[model samples]
Target: MRIRNSVIVITGAASGVGRATALHFARHRVSLVLASRRVEALEALVAECQALGSRAIAVPTDTSEYDDVRQLASRAVQEYGRIDIWVNNAAVSFFSPFLAVPMADFRRVIDVNVMGYVHGARVALERMQDQGAGVVVNVASIVGAVPQPYTSAYSVSKAAVRALGVSLGSELGLDRQKHIHVCTVLPPTIDTPFFQHAANYTGRRAVAMPPVYSPERVAKAILRLAERPRHELVVGRLGRSMVRQHRLMPGRMEKVMAHQVENTHLSKKQAADPSSGNLYAPSLDPATAQVTGGWKGRRRSARRTLAGAALLGVGVVVLADRLRTART
Candidate 1:
């Protein structure tokens, strides 16, 4: 469990939460196998980790391919003589109505988000079974626990992750082959290029959610979990509240969410590629703190969203009869 000199394999290490966690583990002197399709970024991350005095390798892995995942495990074992921990962190997102989202995007999302994690868990379990101990960590989202509008595919993929974690954890508990453990970490929106990199079915991207937690906060939690494995951990009070509210009142929650989406919708605007797609340049390292100026800007935008939604919902309710009559 000690990260110091422990061997760990992480997927999607090119950016975002994966990048942050890789650096955090490196700082703790953990040996690392960092994987992603972005060879440039992965190499940079590997160099960073090595500079911190940890043995590391950068593997260009496409998690959607089962063979690629298998090779990832084999390469790590070949280099380190064993695998200790495997983290499934690669994922993609789409924002739009389910009916409008393209089939290609849907399939790709499933291939990367759901099946990728499944592959990691499967390979990690096999190696752990051989060694008599190991750990597997999955990075799901708050969406795994609570569904939201404009992210049907994204929500479904995360929900699948939640289901897999619980079921696999139960199996690992009883398998008797080793002390292998499965742990899931769910974090709210973080200040990452993820939103910028995500695809949009509606042809536009909404401004990211405010109060986004820094990736370092999530990384710190992962470090803690490594020391003491929990079945699951949810990050941040905001994420926990949303999950609780949805459970407490589904209908009211639906209405509130519907109003918010309608009022703050950016579906009409032209979409731009997310910066995280920029696999070049010095990547955004694990930030220790959130930028205050950026935080305030996002807060103001969020307030306008709330106030506008309340007004729009009231207007729609009052004008319902007139609008229906006109339709006839």
Candidate 2:
């Protein structure tokens, strides 16, 4: 399945990996139905893609809402006549200790991460089945592949996405219309606003994760997945290896991730400041093609390129934690 000129629906398209993927497909002349909560941001992306000669529309959407997602699917089909691919990338994270983690935060994370994917899956499945061919991509996290400390709810949600992908993949294989493919993408902490934006109980600066990847790399992997139609893709090599290591050496891996949870810290946290955490999704500062690898779109975060910078910036090298996280 070629990517060029195909109609694609991408959730979380306002920024991060989804934004990069949207621009990537646009570069290839794909028609796009992009959805996100940020209407201005989505509109900006659509404008950029249109400048690149792709027909793209921005739809302000809350994936957690079933009707909104169904509407998104319907809009894509109505505008483009068919839905070739659907990417579910919207998500939230919780960083307090499991017992202390707020129930509201936990529920919100589940609703957006797990339930959002469910909505996308349900909508895309119907359209794809009717069209006789289509694809769905679930953007999960490597944290869910194996349990880590402080992010218990986030881990649980991601694991559910992985499980859902496995289930959907099997179901599609056995379905009468075998062209409906289900794919999941699991990546480690990428250089995005996720750290600063992640919900935390600790009052301080953003706690860091291990080495992170560029959203562009993950976007490229997703584009490849769209073409090849794989069941699951782990973006970062180290993240993938860590998941395998955890499976074989649970005790050791647990200790490692435990230390990570303990060591991460935040820059500035104010319990009194009532700004909603959702206001700060991981964002990118899109630069010239020279620095960000040809993605000169609006507000895109560049992955660390220098070996030392990459090691230092990503959550991989940092263990300093000023915040709290939920445990298993």
lDDT of candidate 1? 0.75
- State the C-alpha lDDT per candidate: 0.75, 0.75
Using alpha carbons, what is the TM-score of model 2?
0.82
Looking at candidate 2, what is the lDDT of residue 204?
48
Candidate 2 wrongly placed segments (more than 4 Å): 265-276, 279-328
TM values, all candidates: 0.81, 0.82
Task: Superpose all Cα atoms of candidate 1 onto the true structure and report the RMSD in Å to 1 decimal.
Answer: 7.3
Candidate 1: residue 271 lDDT (0-100): 67
lDDT of 2: 0.75
Worst 10 residues of 1 by lDDT: 288-297
Q: What are the runs in model 1 whose C-alpha is more than 4 Å off?
A: 176-178, 257-328
